[model samples]
Target: MVARRRRGAADADQYKPEAHSSDGAVVYVRVQEDGEFVITDDDGQPYDETELRVLRKYAGEGMRDMLQQACDRLNADLSALATVHCDTLSPRDKPAFQSRAFPEPEPQRNPLLQPTLWSRIWPPARRRLEEQNERRAEQYTRAFSEWEEAARAFNEQERQRREQETELVLTNLDAMANILEEHLGEIPWPRETSVSFDLGDDASTIAIDIELPEEDAFPDVEYTLAAKQPKVSVKKIAATRRRMLYRDYAHGVAMRVLGEIYHRLPTVQVALISAYVPTLDTGTGQPTENYLYSVLVTKSQWREINFKALANIEPPATLERFELRRKMTKTGVFKAIEPFDVEALANEVGI
Candidate 1:
């Protein structure tokens, strides 16, 4: 900025330059990864917490006007230099500058590509926009035509369906009337005490459902029977299920089985599996001796155990302990330490 003043009757001028972000304290602006301007402190760390008031104070009002003035002045200087380039610098001083001040003159580009700003841009841009609009209009027209065609096709299908519905109703009418006649033909129309035909909502081609009045319209006894239907159906489904109730009840069962084979049965240890598979057994006197790989439980041996994890419930339920859990014998028959029916337990508990 330049200022004029009169001092001692002589005119004087003073100039001041604006401060930049990198002026002092190593404070500089950098573009962050998020594409926002970041003001870094002297230590090279990004500003942590900054107040808008402090920023506003630094980048005070009318800052845009100051920037605009700078740009305008820069443009004016560039314009003057531009005219110099056109009239004098293009063929004359450029050669001089290239020859003396700088050595290279490989046909440098025009200082800034031309018509200064707009003329170089308008022609190609306008042509491109026109072409784009033409393409868009053609696409829109084609889409509209396709949409209209589809709509017409759909409407024609609907019209055919309506005609088919009319024919179906007409064809079914006589049959329906005959059935009604068979059911109520003996009684005169007015003489019949109460005659009602089941009516239905608008139906599709594949289905017909009677729009019966709501359950509230029926007596309480009928509602009770309907309410029991779900429970009865669930009971029937539960009765058909074939699953051991105590299968998941035991903890560390896999570890127990591993311990039993590794610690109890010495020949069937982990390393001897292949040896056992290929060798003959002394007890059976055959390579393929019949052995019980697994035991099946009889209904009497099934134990009632709840294995719902303790951590899930409030305050946790006390874990129940039972001695000598009943198991199936080698014959698949059950030997129970205590007698109990396990299969019907879940239904009894409403689970």
Candidate 2:
């Protein structure tokens, strides 16, 4: 057998979006562009642009993939939960009723032993044996009846439990969220993070808010040898290069989300995903935000595109079928887009 190697911390730390969770807790979403797509958490803090660099580091993957994974985990957990305790009922002790006849007093045993001690003893002893047998037969009959009753109750409980589980799967949104939370809770992270989901009417449409790390998290740096000495320094990246990377990352996140959602919830044709970055508005000392990326797409239209064929697709490329609103300036700042119209998207997808 080949030896298996253990994974290192760096390898284990590869970006994994938090599993989709539906606890009522707020989910803060910060996009990298302008302040267009910001969802405040329970803290009621406003968006801050200066903090954007920090917020981009821990951004999670789209909810669709997370949810799909959660569903798989839930199915496994439910399968385990669905198992009923087996009732190992031993077979009841059945009495074999055979004909038992008493000897006729042994014919006075050699006639000379008339009125001997054993003659009196044998008659009484036989009577006692007959009585003991009757008692035991009654006891066995009651034990069998008790065993049958227990078996019936066990079966009835198991049937009801199965029906309840089926209903939970069909209609319990809370249960789904809880399962997602449980699944996500297993991932490793340096800090505590939470996931929350919003469902449109009839689960037909969905929106997700994922908190992400700041811009500083992605360092543009390299290790080098200068003057025969090893050194590390920051690498200056071009605006276009950085822009492309940011856009690609955002798009990748969206595609991952959309793809996973389509896989598990094909019925939900419309989806809106927004990434938010926290930063401080240089002018105001308070925190602000940039809309890193957002996309609205329908499964019906997206279903046709072979995502794997294209080497690279930006966020705008996916919005060809519908309307989009975003602000971009020459200074490398991106403004947020207008609020997405779920109803319009839902209708467009013919949901």
Winning model by TM-score = 2
Candidate 2 overall lDDT versus native: 0.42
Which candidate ranks first by lDDT, i.e. highest?
Answer: 2
> What digit string (tens of lDDT, one per residue) describes model 1 on residues 1-351?
111111111121221123233223333343222223344454656555553245335653323333333333323322221121121100111101011122222232223222424534788766666666677667666766766676666667656444433333334433222332332323221111122222112110011111111112211110011132111111111211111111111111211122222221111111100000123657877764121111112111112222233223111011112112335332222222222222222222221
TM-score of every model? Answer: 0.19, 0.42
Residue 219 local lDDT, model 1 = 15
Model 1 CA lDDT for position 326: 34
RMSD to true structure for each model, in Å? 40.4, 25.2
Give one digit per residue, the lDDT tens place, for model 2 in 1-351.
Answer: 111111111111212224223443343433222212343444647536544333332323333333333333323312221111111111111211122233222222121213446545798765565566666666666766666676666667556444433334234444333333433344332222223345544445666544444434332322222332212222455656555444444444445445544443424457676656667888987896566555676666666665555344443455444444456543335666555555655665554
Model 1 scores worst on lDDT over the 10 consecutive residues at: 88-97
